[model samples]
Target chain A: MFPGKYQAVHAAALTVVLLALAASGVQAFIFSDPGSLYTAAIPDSWIYQAYHSTDQLAVFYGEGDWDLLYFEGLGKVADQSVRELAERSLALYGEPGGLSGFQLETPLLPVEVGGLQGLACAYTYQDERGNLLWEYRIFLLLPDGEGFSIALGSNGPWVKNNPPVLEEVLKKWQWTD
Target chain B: MAVDRLRKLSAWVIVLLFFSVIAAPVQASAASSGKAGAARFERALGGGAVPEILKQYGGEYVLPLGQRLWVEEVFRRLVGAAERQDVEYTLTVLNSAELNAFALPGGYVFITRGLVNAIGRDEAKLAAVLGHEIAHIEEKHGMNAVLRQMGLTVLLEVGMLAVDFASADLLRLAGTTLLELISRGWGREAEFEADLVGQTLAVRAGFDGSGAVSLLDGVLNLDSEDLPMKVFRTHPDTQERRERLEANLASFWPPPAAVDDPQVLERLNGGRILAQAGRNDPRGRYIVSLQENGAGLHIFDLQLGESALWLEGASVRDFAWSPQGQYLAVTLDEVSGDAVWICDRWGHVKRQIDLGRRRASQLSWSPEGKQLALLISDSGSQGILVTYAEADALVPMAADLGVEYSTWLEDGLFIFTGDAWYCISPPPVVPVTVQNPVPQVLQRQRILSPTVIKEGSTIRLTRPSLTMP
Candidate 1:
């Protein structure tokens, strides 16, 4: 009868601690968030309306993160033609996301999209804002017309200060005609 | 304390050993998967397709040796002769000793110097060869071979991998073994069909179909000892067929009238025959231009546009662009003796490769730009396609196409259109194992038209209408 009091007390404490741990684990599992982004295409045209809040980019001809060939084919020429368009476009408008007053470097990778026809490009250009913006750009020539697209996102300490919401929303903007 | 430490270490070792045993099989499976993937890739690229590969060896550059100007003139004449038939062509003379000829993917025809020399100045024999090569193209033999090759490669790789041979080395070994097994899959029927088609074409183009018989006779006599083996290995039985051809002189339509023109004969003979060729030196990718006269040619480029230059006129025609763009020498042609010029994309002279007296005719460059092929031709014996470098001439690429008037599509690939037989190269030496088999063959579409524009990046040619009865 004297030993029974200590055993009962130990069992009660163990049960309380176990319940707390299980509850905490369940809460974490239910509320933790994962990161992802994607786009949906509409009918009758090759335009895509993105549906995410993070910086989004895509390649139509070549692969890798920094490809501009998908945008170039919108201009109508296929294959290495995208590279030429990208180079020429960069020369006309400077860099798409850097502060070097539009200084865009040519693509370093061999990624292409839409068969073996288009190449990709990645660059940095300065936006209207004096602040430097890093942008992912693409060059493509579609059956309809030539096109160039830019995705501007904040980089460095600035990105942590202001999230890429504007750039994320703009990813949906594309030429339909 | 020491004993306790020793026990702990032993326990750790046991755990490590257990993991190794458990993971080894999985790692092996992963390695096998990589190999399987590689094999599939190789097959897709047609890298291990031996007959196709052999047919392509040293076939990318134009031979810049011999009387290049005269050869060009001969080609121009052939173009004129083809005007009536409304067929456009691309020609290349290969530098090799084997008496062979072939048509390639797209409209490409190659002839070897050996065939040229053996046939001598016989215009009829040359016409026969041209007709046969053109017939192969008309029947789409090259395309068939390519399609079959690609399909076989995929099936073979997938089938082998399914059988658990998943190692990369296994895939490679399987590919090699399969290549040897699949060499020269074209059989007798295709050869006969090509022969018939060639004969018909000769008659349509105003040449005597008897030329076919004469050309065959020349080929038989030139390599009489090996004719049976060659015919048996690559074609169906020919004795009865030859007899039929010999006896049925009435069946072969005659040239409606006795209109004789040496220039027409020369054009047909010089341009169409002995034009099997290719390039060396890790030859770059080829861009082909098919003209109305049923004549076509492949030009190698560096960065495209005006910057591109034609690597023509070396007696050996041995240098070509590699993937990284290197050059090598392979064969020697007799016409390479004259001054040869490398033309820019605009056909302007860029550089010269000279061979004093020995004329070069057949030329090819490797796709990787690491090797070159040259064929030497003369009045003596037909020349051979030799592999070489700037100074060192290596072994012959193969003996199927000759070097006279030729062009290359890429390294290891060419069109040998010569002397009544349009043949692919590296000689797909079939062994005596398979039963009556339908060997794969190459075929292409023949466009008969006249080119009118030569400016810009495109050419417009008037399509010719065929009045088939």
Candidate 2:
């Protein structure tokens, strides 16, 4: 159980949200999928199954929420080119109702995780109505030459409220190669 | 004169009637605002009620449940995959914007809609959160808190009545919502421990172990500006956790690379849809009395509109349920006193357990329903866990963690929230002798005050002394 020490902090946080509202009325927001930042082409089926299997996944019921799974199959692609993949994915999936326009950050961070090369990026989108929807994207470049992208976007009125369940579908995506 | 009087009366009557009609609608509108103005509304206004405010703000929503059910089902499957016990677990939707999740003893896990909504978009991050909370339950965090708060005798006593002492402590706790407690935003060591366990679980389940880092990193970013301050203020400092995670990654997944499982997200989304249908109806019958938000035990029949099967008094803190559903055991103490009142399901005083001049800090019941445990301390430092029987016979089982609170999972396994746990076997079979523990060290450690314990047939308490320190 949380102790009495945290009341002030939460109370303050509440004030911040309220203040944000006063400055700008509550607005809807969403994200455009940042294109695939895959290092190389990987089979989508393996990516899909990793998302499908319930055994190893956890659907967090908190912020940083997502459906997570591991996959194998993608060979490494050039780091910069993977940004193109992310752009493509965003162009295909990021239609802008929950978000305005989506933009991506670079993806060269080396992450220690399952044997796949990890690509991390951030997305900024405006909802169709034009609110700020911020999404942080994580793409795992698998060992077998395939890659899967994990995008977290919010569609909530304040910012965006995209539920992490979207990862399940993205996980299933495979490469033609 | 008669005609003039009649005309005047007529005029007055017409004016009164006209005003009444005008006032009616205005009054109704004000009343609606008042209802929505309450604290609950504040909660709703945050993120819980986002659907209604999306257009007002600038957010998009996926119609028909928002994958809430998909997330639930996906988590459930993972729970099953992890072999979580088959017990009736009810989830309360906490209305907060912070990243938090916690499980109360007795299969009760409360996750905020904010958390649910957030998890729907990212599979790995979602996994990290679920795995962490599940680990808390798996590791018996609730039970441990009970062990650290109360002792065994009062635990068994309140068990029959569904009482909990931790409520006061939980209320006394610093945060406004339960999420803070689960996230251990206060830098709780137990929280860090849960995170560790969660990371291992994620890896064992074939997830990228670093998911925790991703999740934490994302959570840290929510504040936007206070990144450093927030990280330092919360449990396990985000950066340190990431570094530690990098070191531990090798032990679990070899090569430690990022892997993708798109299917996991698909199932989660599907599960979220189904779960949305099953979400609890806040308008149901078991309404809290208008006088109190939630003071004592709040129980509703499977069907709403039914009478509350049981309720406890305000000062009568924390309780545990009987495995057989026959009774509840509760602990009662003055806001700041040395006496602890043990009560039963019907709200009758069973007997008072005295902590020898010092007030009892907490009480707990073992899963077996036969034995009880008590944690008595004064001024925070001195504490001990006394294993006893509901029959008024007390016995000393183990010491350490200062026995602040205790809860039983089942049989010999019980978690003392202070430091470790005590696995009392065969019902303690003999009576316990009470002893006075030193009070200094007890005050420094964080302990669970109001606690609840629920255990099934298969749960085992193998360790005698499991210390957190």
User: What's the i-RMS of each model?
Assistant: 25.2, 23.1
The best candidate in terms of TM-score: 2
B1-469: candidate 2 lDDT, tens digit per residue: 9999999887656545533533344343444433223222323212322233233223332322224434554465446545445334444455455345655433455455556666655555565777776776666565445333322223334542122222232222212333333333323676777788877776555454555666665665567564322223546557666556545543541211121345533443334222122112233423222114334545554443454523344454555434443334555555555444444433355556655556553355555444455556556644444433333323433343444344444334333443333333331222111111100000001122322333321233321111110
Tens digits of per-residue lDDT for model 1, A80-168? 45556555555434422113454344453443332224344444544334434444443444343334343323232232222233222
Model 1 lDDT at residue B171: 44
Error of 2 at A133 (Å): 26
DockQ each candidate and list the results. Answer: 0.01, 0.02
Reproduced native contacts, each prediction: 0.00, 0.00
Q: After superposition, how far is residue B75 of candidate 2 from its true place, in Å?
A: 0.7
> Per-candidate TM vs. native?
0.26, 0.27
Q: Among these predicted structures, which one has the highest DockQ?
A: 2
Over B359-457, each residue of candidate 1 has an lDDT whose tens digit, in order, gives 555445544333344555445434443332222222333233443333333312333334322222221111111111111101111233444776334
